[model samples]
Target: MRREIIDYLKFLMGAPFIKGYRLIGETHLHIQYYSEFEEFKSDHPMSEYTKEEFDQYFNENDTLKKLLVGESVRLLRQFSYLECVTIEIKSYDRVVVEVHSSRFILNKYFGFNIEDLSLGDNTWKSMFVDVYLADPAKRNELYEKIVCKFNQ
Candidate 1:
């Protein structure tokens, strides 16, 4: 998943000014992106997925559904049900306009019961998945920067 995320990020950072993006640590998840584009910089706004929205993410797609035959979504959804959106959206960022984020963390396999999650207290694991998080305005600003960087 990490490799896939990086590959996708690299593919999206096709802007010319972007020298490249590198990994950063200390925080839960971090990546440093270098850009020759004059507008590029370290400051960019990032976003987060609310608790309810995160729950919906898992409810829509359940891993157990993979066990079904033919792999059709209909067949998968017939039996399996999502108690909660197990994936906790810790953070997300947008790399370039239209493209995905630079870094974020999502936690999967949350909750206690398969049918329903623990309402009061549930444990979750932090998953450093692919993607970035940024507000639309920030994303546009970043996108413009990427375009400028690439165009130069």
Candidate 2:
């Protein structure tokens, strides 16, 4: 199930996702990546929001959700690399929620991109669906937002 879920999440990345980065999710419950949005990372916004807080903000903001769900997600193409990412079930109906992984845990234990290094001189980044979203639902709800060409 873990591999299957990862495949599905990777599918969200489609042909645009570069090798090395990972997609973490479970069925239809949660999905996310560990990259910074180019817009946010451009000036180095230094997000004041933690994973939970950032998730809550996106879940509650309709405008932001709309932006993500519609035809404006192309802005993700500006980032060089996504440092750390994880997806969790805020509320899942099918399976019992137990061991959803945390970005902090992945970063601390598994060394999930702590150095913030880019894959290859920032030629093509993998900040696809996983990095652009906070709430997993927003990702599912916003598939149309993807507009980045996978030419790199």
Candidate 3:
């Protein structure tokens, strides 16, 4: 799963930017776009998942989904404050994003159950994932779709 996630991200290496939302609460959803994303650092390095335990856990899951570009993704807001969205390459509609939070020492999981989420919670929020296509001609089409869905 770790390698699969990295590979999906790498597929966007040539993309100019990626854009998505940061849901603050029930009433607020903020747009957070990133340029120079290839240079952006991941707070929790992928190395953490290399441990034998995580490897076993990943292998045990016969249904682990693979991420892809343009598909909606869900992640646990456990490691970082930045809200993120990722596309799955394969799976039955399960997405998990983990962001590091300075407020907690232990890594936690969110989005396990949608009913468990609360609007006022600062550490967690749900969002969609979008990646700018590397081809300039195709970007406008996607941009228009994004505007219609998010910009309102």
Clashes of each: 11, 4, 18
How large is the C-alpha RMSD of every model relative to the true structure?
18.0, 16.5, 16.5
The TM-scores, one per candidate, come to 0.20, 0.21, 0.20
Residue 54 of model 2 has an lDDT of: 39
Tens digit of per-residue lDDT, candidate 2, span 4-40: 4335344442112111323333212333222323323
Residue 65 lDDT in candidate 1: 18
**Candidate 3 on 1-152: residue-level lDDT in tens?**
23333344333322222233444542222322232222222322442333343333223222111112222222322213323342211112222221221112212222243223334662123321222333334333433333212110
Q: How much does candidate 3 score in TM-score? A: 0.20
Order of models, best lDDT first: 2, 3, 1
lDDT measured at residue 150 in model 2 versus the true structure, 0 to 100: 15
C-alpha lDDT of residue 18 in model 2: 16
Q: How much lDDT does each candidate structure score?
A: 0.23, 0.32, 0.27
- Candidate 1, residue 62: CA error in Å? 37
Task: Report how far off residue 118 is in candidate 3 (Å).
Answer: 39
lDDT of 2: 0.32
Expressed as tens digits, the lDDT of each residue in 7-37 for candidate 1 is 5444322222223333333212122332212
